[model samples]
Target: MPRKLKVFRTAAGFYDAYVAAPSRKAALAAWGAERDLFARGAAEEVTDPALMEEPLAQPGTVIKRSRGSAAEQFAALPADRPKPKRVAKARTAKVEPAPPPEPAPKPSRDALDAAQDAIDVAERDWRKEQRELAARQAALDRERRDATERHEQALADLDRARRRAQEDYDAGLAA
Candidate 1:
């Protein structure tokens, strides 16, 4: 059987989140609230027909309506704000200039020192790794060059051995 749905409203940050649900638990589920918002007095069943329309139309879906933005809230404030009081002073009143503000205390350099130290350590570690990588590259290049030299030498030795064997065979045949 289909359960009867009711519109529920709650304050979500600066906006109001509304939903049509069968129960308070269903409403909380729609709002994705882990705790009981109704128990916390943050949520309540909305009876206002004007506020209920949108939520009832889309049942179980959360509808966020802006209460007021920061600027709008300030604009909504009462325009009859108290004005600054005007003091009656004689025209000959000599107003002494205020003393210069004292120099502010120097800010702590501990955080800066720690950050610099961390950067220095990082740089040192990076340079160490770069040097290790360069050394490995140099070793690899040397090994490659050595292998090429050995290969050429082996080829020359085999060629000479073959030529000597061929010459000996021709000499024996002639004899």
Candidate 2:
């Protein structure tokens, strides 16, 4: 007979695990050794089989029935009756005249010059901002490096002081 185990974990709530082993000790040993089974949870044997069985349907759950399956429901359809013959009618198509092409407006010389000046100014400003940003980033990076070095130096000094104190105490105790 298969043994059922209830495993619980922080992440995964609770689950039923089936073990093929005969004894609980054997099952625990086998499961504990196998990393794949209950990888994250704590496991214990469960006596009730109802914990493992899942309900076929829950309350308020809708089961969809296909209309095609009920052939008798559509047996009385009007498809058995012959459809009325459609009468053919003549349709007249009207011809439409093509619209005149619109003329394209020419740009003024001053407008063109102004647009070019705006683009040049924007480009210059972008480059200047980029250079300033790079300088600031470099300065920040230098400061961070200096701070890290100072921290390490302080740690080394503390270690040296501790060692000196320990050595002095040891020498006094030996005397």
Candidate 3:
């Protein structure tokens, strides 16, 4: 008959892997190789024939009611002390009235033209940088592909050399 085993974790942060085998030595050996046991904490064997006769309880569905005392003692705790209040200060200096705001000067035609030219130059530079980046990426990809092809070719050449050497050695043995 197959044995039932349970693995559990201990309070010491170490896993206690349990496995039921024919012998204690066999159980230890099986436990060492059990990946789940090493990852978990502890285990117990619940293979009693009498326990198996009882029906299994449905998980999360069954609610067991607990007994409570008829007379319960109640106590009110003291509240924390309130913070001290701050004193208000009297103002002595007289406040001055604020002056009216001045209107902003409008931009000149030359300034507007210069601003548009600067924006155009910035966009042109950005496009140029994007193109340069694309070119660099393409070059890097090409180099990587070339290197991989070269490596594969070298491996094929080495295999051919080995086969030739083996053939020559067999021919010499025959002679």
Best candidate per lDDT, number? Answer: 1
Model 3: per-residue lDDT, tens digit, 91-123?
Answer: 876567887788888867998899999999999
Put the candidates in TM-score order, highest first: 1, 2, 3
Estimate the TM-score for candidate 3. Answer: 0.34
Mind giving the per-residue lDDT tens digits that candidate 1 earns over 80-162? 96889998897898888999999999999999999999999999999999999999999999999999999999999999999
C-alpha root-mean-square deviation, each candidate: 18.9, 31.3, 31.4
For candidate 2, write residues 69-157 as lDDT tens digits: 34654673657767899976546755568887878887679988999999999999999999999999999999999999999999999
* TM-score of each model, paired residue for residue: 0.41, 0.37, 0.34
Any runs in candidate 1 off by more than 4 Å, and if so which?
Answer: 75-175
Superposition TM-score, candidate 2 onto the true structure: 0.37
* Candidate with more favorable, higher lDDT: 1 or 3: 1
- Superposition error at 36 for model 3 (Å): 91
TM-score for candidate 1, residues paired by index: 0.41
**All candidates' lDDT scores?**
0.94, 0.56, 0.54
Least well predicted 10-residue stretch by lDDT in candidate 2: 55-64
Give the clash total for candidate 3. 9
